[model samples]
Target: MTRARALDLARILFVLLTLGCAWLGFRGRGDEIADALADTSALGLAAALLVTLLGLALTAILWRRILARLGSPVPERAASAIFFVGQLGKYVPGSVWSFAAQAQLGRRHDVPARRSVTASGLFLLVHTATGAVVGTAAVVTGVLDAGGPRWLWALGLVAGAVVLALPVVRRDVGPAMVLMAGVWLAYGVGVLALLGPARAGLDDLPAIIAAFALSHVAGVLLVIAPAGLGAREGVLIALLEPVVGLDAAIATALLARVVHAAADFAIAGLAALRARRTGVRPSPGLRPADRRTDL
Candidate 1:
């Protein structure tokens, strides 16, 4: 098989692995899911979905800010759609479909494939780092009780930073870092607000950060899981149970997945409709001349 084919296979395996993990997580634990679902009120689920959508929108804004700093700015509508649409590509395995779609759209905007990939990578690294910092803070200050296994936060940050600082990433690292810091500050405030009465005292900050970090991390890893079915719940049970209790955390993760999938469907559906109306042929990758065209 070719290099691309090998990479694709790996992603498929990741999806399978995620499914296996999720199965193991819930195996013989039917009562756990039953209890979690029973406690999950419709209002609570709705609220969780709203929060997830809002968080993703904020992420889109962050992406726009980074792209502006990169000199290949894409409008918010296009960027947001691209972000949502990209979510569907995880079904292709190896996550290549996401990159492939990005490259295709970027090319339309006249962006080089390398630059497009770098841009996407930078956004991910920054987002992950920001979440890690916040999650670690939550754990540290007693806002969350998972402080014992807090090494994961530090390790994730270091690994993210290393990838971001690599030579290829370095070309855009300067601007990306600056934008990321600003965004991180905003994100910190937002989550603190979410924690509301739960966030008090500086000691609680690290643990709060850790919770947010773990939540985001869990969401991301869901891409490799089958339709994100059990992966989110598993992560909540593993990392968030100590902080928020298994039932609440599991509900939160499941609700988040529902919202994410809804957004993806909404965005992709609109894109498809628009394409059909406009009679524009859809290319498989990013073209260089599409930067100014509206999606």
Candidate 2:
């Protein structure tokens, strides 16, 4: 088979594997989720969803900053749309199509593919790093209690730290990592807001944040399923189950995904509409957004 075809097949298999994991995980908690859903007030769900939306918006802002740093300067609306659309590819497996999607969108406005990809990579790296630090602290302090092996969190932190340090290694680090940390902090605040009274205290907040963030990054890195659906729940539960009950944390994670999905599609649809109205086409590859002018 051609390389492209083989790659596609691999992605399909991974996606299937992820879905299977999610199914089994949920199956184990099927009755629990149902019970929680039945008891969970629509108001609470709404609050959680709102918090998630806020996080996504913050993500858009973060992406906007990264693009700006690269000289692309995507409009907030466009950045938001590009972000959400790329999210759709999370289910696609193997390929980091989300990054490709964002870079392609930037090209319409003259962004260079390399610069765009670099910015995106840097943002992701920092975000994951921040999550790692936060998640580990949480586990150490006993915030989340999901029952996975302890070594996983250690491995995640080490990997994240390595990635975060890559810019220094290249001797030409950019603003991408800083921008990622800022956005991630904002998102963590949003998540805490969703928990309200159940949230971790000021003293424990740092650890809680780290645990939650690391769990999230691990889920994405695992790349087993679309959007880290099951992986997210498992990791979060492992980390947060102590502070929050397993059922509650799992529910929150699921609810967060739902909100993210809704926001993603909503923004993507608008982007598609705008693109059609403006007669713009997606670029052929990922690149930086400001290639028209020399930086």
Candidate 3:
């Protein structure tokens, strides 16, 4: 009945929810995931998994940065655990679970609920708004690849970055925007890795990255599908099919889902293990107010 005991129980419940959803998600779609992985070479899968993991880590770091801006900086290891574990909630039925889980998970590390929730919201906004710019730049890159000047792609990308940065030029969100831009690029490469060299060359990577960015932006905007399952893949297939052919596009989309989910699971499981072994706590000098707020 004590507040501390209540919080500990709630934390356990949230982690269980995330892990359970992850289990059901894999159980429900294992066949499709296996087929997708089977289509790619072992090397391709390895590369995709590596990049996806990197992207996931960057995403966690992005959230950590946002929390720091909100005056609740957490330790890197604990932040990683909180973030990747919280991310498991995306497998559940709604987008809000991930945010909610992160808010509760932060309690163990001394982050206030308001700070964690605010960071989650800002993280989503940064991810999406920057994603739109990244997606648009990909279109520019695609146009140049198709017929226009090849060098213009760089110009287009700069334009897109500037557009996103100008409005938030002095705001704390600016760096987070920059980091999300890089995260999208990393994930785009993860998608590109699923393709064969013959199917998509470096020259074509920009176009592929564009399509990937656009698809994810669509996924974020469409809140109905958990983790952007149907909508993301659908948009990806539609946009990518033209460039990579229908068969290759569909395979890439499936492979992307499998690879991305693997990244989430792998990182979360690893972070969980790390937290268990080390027994993490709040950063030194955590505010008394933060300690009291979330409880």
Candidate 4:
């Protein structure tokens, strides 16, 4: 079979697997999930969704910056379309899927294959490193009590950032870092919104944010797990257990997963629709080199 056909098949299977995981995740907690959802304030949920969108938008902006730095400047609308639509590939079983998708979609807009891949790689590396920095800071500052070896984690984050700095210019790093900080902060606020109905106190906000960041980092690192499936929730629950009881933590984690998926799909769909309405089409007769074999 052709590489494109294989990728299509893999995506389909991954979608099915994601659905299966979601079904299994909430199977036994139906009543709790319902209760949690029913109790959640509509305004708060709306705010969470809005914040999620903002975070995603920031990510797209960051990606655009990375692409431009790599000398592949596309229009903002086209960049959004490429970023959001390609982001759907994260649901696939491997981390490379999103990068591959972005490269393919980016080519339609005259972004070279190598540059697209470089931008995607740098985007991910920055995100991961920032997450570690944020997470480790929280842990070392006595925000989250995940016990021992916090210093080691902090050291590791610094080391990783240093390595990533080789490809990123000092000028581009500031804005990208600031944008990513906003992204994670927005996501943390969304998590706070999710936990509000559970009466999780304001005092635990730092821990919650830390857990959210750390769990996300963990999810990204565990590439074999589709969309960081169980890894994120597990890490979240563990980290949050001290602040909120186990049950509340579990409910919050589950709710987060649902909201995240919703946010991703909503943005992708809206971006695609917008691109269609605006008549944004790929450059004629342009084809990207096949990078699927690398995956």
Candidate 5:
């Protein structure tokens, strides 16, 4: 079989495996999620989704900055559509899918494949590094204090990626890491907001944030799980249960997965519409080729 076909098969099998694991886990303890949902606060969920959206928007801005730095900048609308729509690929198995999608989508907006791919690579690198650093700090402060040394390997990986991509994104390292930290912070806040600060308590905030960041890194590094589906939830629950108890931890994990997925599609949908209806208008001196820019 061709490499493409093999990859497709692997994705399908891994997806099935993830689904099977989820089904079994939920089957035994489905009542926890249901009970949690019964007690769930609408205001909290709404607040969570709002913060999650804000984080996602920040991510798009980061991508746009990366693109511009690479000399293949698209308009804001074009950037949104390209970035969000490309992000849909993360739902598929494989960490590289989103990057590949971004690179392809960019070509429609006069962004060359090479620059777009490079920018996406750098974006992931910067994002991973920030998540690692933040996660490590959080862990040191409260969560898994003993495991902090082992987790330094994650920091090492980040350092290696930054070294490799530094030449291209040297100017963006500081800002990109800061922006990525903001994204994680927003998501951490969203998780707390969803669970209700009363449940997690202000004292638990740092641990919650640490759990959020580390669980995400675990999910991404696993790679076999689509969008970190089963892996993220498992790691999240594991990290949170100690602080929040089993029921609240499970609820937070499940709700976060659903809310974050909804947020992703929402951003993708709106950006797709915006790009389709109103991207950058062509100027009078434009060539016919430039006028044909597809959303």
Candidate 6:
């Protein structure tokens, strides 16, 4: 079979797996999930969705900055569509899917394949570094205190600082960091909005934010898990347990997963619509002609 056909099959299987996971996640807590849905305020859901969109917009801006720095700048609209739509590939069982998607989508807008790949790589690096820094600080500052060896957290902080310094050393600083900060902050806000529907208190806001950062970082690093399926929720619940108790933490993680998945699909759908309207055809896989630009 051709690579395109294989990719199509893989995508179908990934979708099935994602749905299966979601179904199992909600199965044991059917009544609780239903109650939460019934009690959810329309306004709260809208607010969460809006915050999610804002976070994605910030992420798009960050990607644009990265591409421009790599000397393969595309228009903002193209960048937004490429980033958001490409994000859908994260649901697949490989970390490289999103990068591959972005590189192919970028080529439609005249970006060289190597530069596109570099931009995606750099974005992930910066994003992961920032999450590490924030997560470590939160833990060290007594926010989520997971009670591991203090030296390990300290080492993580040092490593994060070094990773973060690479971009600054390369003179690709300032706006990228600011935009990434906004992206994470918006994510924190969206999580808080999820908590609102559950009537969870915001007294431990600092811990919650730290948990968000740490769980996300953990998820990203665990590339074997599709979209960090079980890993993210496990880490999130573990971090939140001290502050919210086991049951509430579990509920929060489950609900947050559903909300986050909805947000991702919503943005991806919008981006797909935009790409279609602009007459841009998404490449299913790399062709011989497309592989000329080496990474």
Colliding pairs, model 3: none
What are the Cα lDDT values of the candidates? 0.53, 0.58, 0.75, 0.77, 0.73, 0.73
6-88 in candidate 6: lDDT tens per residue? 86575556446555644555567777766665555677667777887888878878887777655565666668877876777
The window of 10 residues in a row where model 4 has the poorest summed lDDT is 286-295
Candidate 6: residue pairs that collide: none
* Candidate 2 lDDT trough over 10 residues, lowest sum: 286-295
Say which candidate scores most in TM-score.
4
Output the number of the lDDT-best candidate.
4
**TM-score of each candidate structure, all chains considered together:** 0.60, 0.66, 0.82, 0.84, 0.79, 0.82
Error of 4 at 182 (Å): 0.7
Model 4 ranges with Cα > 4 A deviation? 1-32, 167-169, 281-295
Give the poorly placed runs of model 2, Cα more than 4 Å off: 1-35, 140-162, 168-208, 270-295
Cα error of candidate 6 at position 125, Å: 0.9
User: Which consecutive 10 residues in model 5 have the weakest lDDT in total?
Assistant: 286-295
Candidate 4 Cα lDDT to native: 0.77
Q: Which pairs clash inside model 4?
A: none
Q: What is the lDDT of candidate 5?
A: 0.73
Tens-digit per-residue lDDT, 63-131, candidate 5: 888777656657888899888877777776667777777776776667777777777876776666567
Cα RMSD of all models vs. native, in order, equals 8.1, 7.0, 5.2, 5.2, 7.0, 5.2
Q: State the lDDT of candidate 2 residue by residue for 98-179, as single tens digits.
A: 6776666566556677777776776665566667755664554455554567677667557666765664323323454454
Judged by whole-model lDDT over C-alpha atoms, candidate 3 comes out at 0.75
lDDT of 5 at 145: 39
Cα lDDT over the full model 6: 0.73
